[model samples]
Target: MQTVRVELGERSYDIVIDTGILSGIGERIKGFNFSKVAVISNPTVFNIYGDVVINSIKNAGFETLNVIIPDGEEYKNFNQTYQILTELLKNKLDRKSCLIALGGGVIGDITGFVASIYMRGIDFIQVPTTLLSQVDSSVGGKTGVNHELGKNMIGTFYQPRLVWIDIDTLKTLPKREILCGIAEIIKYGVIWDEELFEFLMHHRESILNLDPLPLTHIIRRSCEIKAEVVSKDEREAGLRAILNYGHTIGHAIETETGYSRFLHGEAIAIGMNREAWLSEIMGFLNRKDALKIKAVIDSYGLPSELPEDLNADKLISHMKLDKKVEAGEMKFILPEKIGKVKIQKGIDIENVRKALN
Candidate 1:
């Protein structure tokens, strides 16, 4: 097994990655003091892995309850959060009880948000079952539901006690899901590790085939990079903001499309490409490097441009609602080059308009 430690002082935890290790999760989390555990998941995921996880937790001597919520980005809202919160209350889960996020990013976000608000705060574990969640959302403590106007506008920096990633879960995912995960992995490369970017460019076939060697390497590297950033900033107060590399415009697309048209990482892939173009136009990145970014993204079969039907005006309007906005001025994490990015604030709306168009 490979491990990445998220060093958050008192709240620090380990992210465990391996193949076919799902059966051992019980012994791994047995050290926590909680007597009761709630596994929160969507129907699709629970149907596949719920019994194994719950049985493992039960064997470890905890009272376990499974709650299944609807699966989709649109279901991540006040309604589902309230429903989970009510279920926890009805089942009498208290401060000493832990919540387990047992699905993908949406499940992880909602479960973490519920744990944060439940009894003023409770321990939560992330058993992310999707590639997108395993490499990205499962590592960071950012948790929240979406609002009609914005993505992740309603969330908290609540940390998890553990992130158990089992690579076998990838086998069940669709090719598009794997591509989505690659988008975030590519984000890590572009924002922090040039070597990682080159690795992806060189080993595309092996990574796409889910070859254990390269697949494990990219996942571990992505987790390590995220762990380092989160440990330093912990709350997006400074250095952590760079992790939002493509998220500024990505979240806007999700909001404008009502979160149904594209998966989160799919939207991010498009955002990264468009933002790379913006970087070039604004003089931060050279055309050759910008094209390189686009080239890699394109090679993955991910979308690299806004749909012609999307209104540029509406997309810009949604961006204004992003959390990065300070005093109503928009900020962007623009790539200066691969392996580095800077937070650019007070950029003219006209420049953003040109990029969107």
Candidate 2:
């Protein structure tokens, strides 16, 4: 087992990583104040590991409430959040009772949001099953639901009490879902660690093969990078914005597709490619490096282009409403090099449209 710490002073928590760690979760939660625990997951994920999670809490002598929502990005909304909160009320759970987010990003995001708002505030634990959630969504303390107008437009910065990552859960993920996760892992390399980028390039085959050693290294390194970033800028006030390198246009794609067509990482893979192109055009990145970026993204078997029939103008319109917009301008986390990015603001909208085209 390995641990990464998100150093937020009073809110700091450990991200524990290992295989089959889920079985030991009861021991991990032993001292928390909550007697009754709520496990929030989607029907699909709940069907897979529901019994084990419930049994773990039960063995620890805590009452467990199962809250299962239909699994999908479209379900991450105010209505679903209301449903979880209603369950808490129906069971008469107090603020001391913590919420356990036990699935992928959608489950983690909304579950955390529900915990943040229910009865003012309640602690939440993140047991992210998917690679996307384990590396990105589960660590940052950024929790929210998507709005039709834009993705993650409605949200809050609330940290989880603890994050328990059991890589064993990934065995059940589909190939497509694993690709989605690889996209985010690539993002960490692109924005921060040059060595990580090189490591990914060298181990591309190992990653595709899902060998245990490389997989463990990737997760631990990604978590370490994310933990370091969030520790410095917990609220995304400045430095942390770089983490959104591909997210500006990525969220737009998810909204345009009604959160159905592409997974979050799929949209992000496309966004990162487009933004790299834009950066090259703006002279921040050279064409050689830009193409290399796209090449790596393509090698992951993820999409790097806007859909053939999707309208560029429509995408720009959606981007205008993104949460990253500041003072009427869309801000982009543009890469200047493989291991560095800049939070570029005041970009011309026409340029974004051109990149989309």
Clashes of 2: 0
Per-residue lDDT tens digits of candidate 2, residues 252-303?
Answer: 8887887789988999999999999889888899898788888888887899
Off by more than 4 A, model 2: none
Q: For model 2, how big is the CA root-mean-square deviation? A: 1.6
lDDT computed for candidate 2: 0.90
20-88: candidate 1 lDDT, tens digit per residue: 888788888888878689999998999999999999999998899999999888899999999999999
Using all chains and alpha carbons, the TM-scores for the candidates as numbered come to 0.96, 0.95
After TM-score superposition, the amount by which residue 248's alpha carbon in candidate 2 deviates from its true location, in angstroms, is 2.0
Q: Give candidate 1 regions above 4 Å deviation.
A: none
Clashes of each: 0, 0
